[model samples]
Target: MKPHDVNSTVHEPSWQIFLIFLRLGLTSFGGPVAHLGYFREEFVIRRRWLSEKRYADLVALCQFLPGPASSQVGMALGLTRGGYPGVFAAWCGFTLPSALLLIAFALGLSEWGEALPDGLLDGLKIAAVAVVAQAVWSMGGNLCPDAQRVSIMVVAACLVLLVNTPLSQVGVIITAAIIGTLLFKPAMDAPHEALPFTLSRRAGAFWLALFALLLLGLPVLAGVFESQGLALVDAFYRSGSLVFGGGHVVLPLLQAEVVPTGWVDRETFLAGYGAAQAVPGPLFTFAGFLGAAMNPAPSGWAGGMIALLAIFLPSFLLIAGALPFWEALRSQPRIQSALMGINAAVVGLLLAALYDPVWTSAIHGPADFALALLALTALSSWKLPAWLVVLGCGGIGIML
Candidate 1:
């Protein structure tokens, strides 16, 4: 929907947007990095929910903040179009499909066969490589347009590889936002997502209340309700609320939540996590993976569903509530500097994440490295479809 369409634009009703994101939630792939590429394709480049610049600002902001960057970005993207409720719908839609699949898959891990159907997982991974490569290039073009900005990315990349920092992703982007604002502050006359003031404000408040209720009252409610499902939900939701970087951070949090409890074994958790990296949407989908796979009380697909929703709900609320405020705030010189520093720091964070988790997990041998290089080449130069590459790679993976 066009921005001017009061009825249809980004402010799309919660239910309506739920469906759109639902499809995307299921299909988006390549992890956090790849998810950005998919998001640009669906929302910025194709759907025109917001302008490229606006989307960049939103992305940069989320990257700098301490949270799941992609999921936060998704929530912010929806907010840009529709406000608080828009954020709610986008998250639900984006989160649901994958959560459901992962939860279901998790429940029957033993029965899931030695491997995925020929070429499926491989294809997804290849597609992911392509998608991330594309995002790297595209973001480079838009964000690193200036020589100075380019320097920031290059330096940030080095920091990530060199420092071996644990949670420096948040630091990288925050640093960039600050630098950007200080050195090259821009005017704020640029286009913005149209918004409805009163409704948006009210919706924002509602989201906050919902989040607070879940956080404070949930434990008590769970104990009374005799629902370990509530405990899982609380755990996941708290994880979502506390993390300071992207989805990978969820690993330690989730491990702490489930492992000591003897729910899923180490192997199962690792395997599920590795597999999750290949799926689309948020890394938090791992909630589904564990929720179903573990045989905890009330665990199964049902627990998986509850866990998935609980974790993502707060993101939707916080993002949407902040959207209206961000439009004006981003234009401020102070905010701009902060954003510049933040974005630069985000580059560093991405660099770190790419190495520690994404690269190490996926590329095991020379052959795997070669395949990854090939996938990157396809993404960077050929513009081949992500799905096709992923399919081809999955075939190779099973065989290898």
Candidate 2:
């Protein structure tokens, strides 16, 4: 099917896009992998905003880039659906809920934190395991159909597990692309479903240039001016720009940036992180908490907003800049073959993530495993909404 045929026949207004994503923002729990599952269900399966292949392609692209993969995908979806306005709307809708919650936690709301049962957060983590498992199972089926692709997926997963670093993930992707180029061949006349991006190459180049300029100039500007705000931007921007795997991989980088500098105390940082897990948006929004909790000036809501914007800005610029060029290149037969490998590798990466942080942290005993299975059944078999399932799991966790 053509790309346009797969998407909504009518272009949605930015407000409508915001509303759609706001619902997602309020409900999407787990982490980045689970977020992808939620997005696939909403856009690909429920709303028919894009085809399965197109969504996978977008995932592959975002995985290759730095910053939060899920948020970048959200931004690209918004861009595709309603142009630039939609991009901002989607980001705000999906991000603000968690960002605000974290900021509140930083600004003394954390004192009341013990009100919730301890099981609630544990339940949420268990639900995330189910969500990520669902994503891996479904995407693995679609993207790794052939033996060559399956082999690529297995090897990629093994490599990611063994190496377990942000740069290692990038290496896996690059290696997958090379292997795909060698192993698969596509017909020259294969049908290409062009992404519905209104951005021109010239505009894309401009965005890319801006991204590079900021990446190079921000630290120098921070050092020269010695402004706390500039330094905050520099720290956060660099953290966002350098992170490859996103999600939890950002933690060490952020800790390094904030802790030793004495911007936030270690206890406050750890507390905000715990609070962040309870919220329902991108983990990158932890930047909001750190900013608000900073000992220096520009702390509070103002600081939170600054850190939030600075960290996510790269994702905006990178997606905007890369899409036009990426779209054109992906239309080629050779590139399509490479993407097949890359997509399979992406599935492998998800699989590895599912095993490590999602599964290891959540599944402590038989009861925890049973809860995850029940959540999975609710998601896959009963066709219950993810938000409902997550809540149910949390309740079950309390009981268990």
Candidate 3:
């Protein structure tokens, strides 16, 4: 996009930006990859808000960051289009619908408790297996291009499966980065000029520092004050702060936090997770569900809002921290090489996720296996929208 297109007040009003993303928030589904498709359709192909190349570049930068990839992309678009207000509007529009839906689901679950039907939740879990499997396949193809990268993916997957700990994801990513640095060498190339409309370095540094402060300070505050709200914030914030690959990768981290603590039961946690797949917007909205469903004082609207904000706060800060430096960072051959390995490992992480909670929990019988195959076909072959596949699977599950 031309500089004037974003810089001029009349060119892209904040309300217009909000409305566009709001529509996406309601309709876009299938997870992060599909969200990208919807974004390209709205911003690039239809509105001409940005060029394909520019959007692709933004996507690359967001992928390298440790947050919700699609939400970060939307936020970055808003930041470029209308500054701070645009960022708020874009996030509000894209996130609120699903956040509200999941929160409502949490409330219903709280009220009904065990009285609700299990069939729908079961179907959703089965559908999630297909959804995550498809994501793993697509991401693996994109990230693991050669034999070496494939090896990285395999090793990462095997290692995580073996270790099977909360810290395993971080370890795999770090190990992959080191191996990548040692094994993969990129050809030297001249650096390009910095892109226009980049955020200031000062802003980046401030956000980075603030992120670190909250990450370190929140736990201390929670302990010192003994505030349940603060404790929830610390836990969710840490989960958001530490996530690398986004989406399903957030699952294990969240499971570790709420399940063992008795904040949320395992069945409810798994059910909410499956239901999150059917919703539009970021999968991180699952935090909202868990917040409302928690068996504590924080289990209400206030809790949902707090969890939502805390989980997403790290994304905003990380994006702010990274965007200003992205121009310089993207030009580095070694960083790019390291990202390649990390990306591959991310696919492996998803692969491991698809097996345990997603696959093992959902597929209990031959009939369930058949339904899962149907869901996969609908998603991968028939090209059905994810929401429809989820609904169809749920219906079929109820019938069975």
Which candidate achieves the best lDDT against the true structure? 3
Query: Which sections of candidate 3 miss by over 4 Å?
Result: 1-11, 113-115, 186-196, 223-226
Writing each residue's lDDT as its tens digit, candidate 1 over 328-370 gives: 5655677655555545444444544455445554555787778
| Model 1 TM-score on a 0 to 1 scale | 0.64
* Model 2 CA deviation exceeding 4 Å by range: 1-10, 109-192, 328-400
lDDT of each: 0.64, 0.80, 0.83
On a 0 to 1 TM-score scale, where does candidate 3 land against the true structure? 0.90
Query: What is the lDDT, from 0 to 100, of the residue 283 in candidate 3?
Result: 95
| Candidate 3 per-residue lDDT over residues 84-188, each given as its tens digit | 788889999999999999999999988885786558778888888888888888878877889999998888878876776656777888888888887777776
Cα lDDT for residue 352, candidate 3: 78
Clashes of 3: 0
Model 3 is weakest, by summed lDDT over 10 consecutive residues, at: 1-10
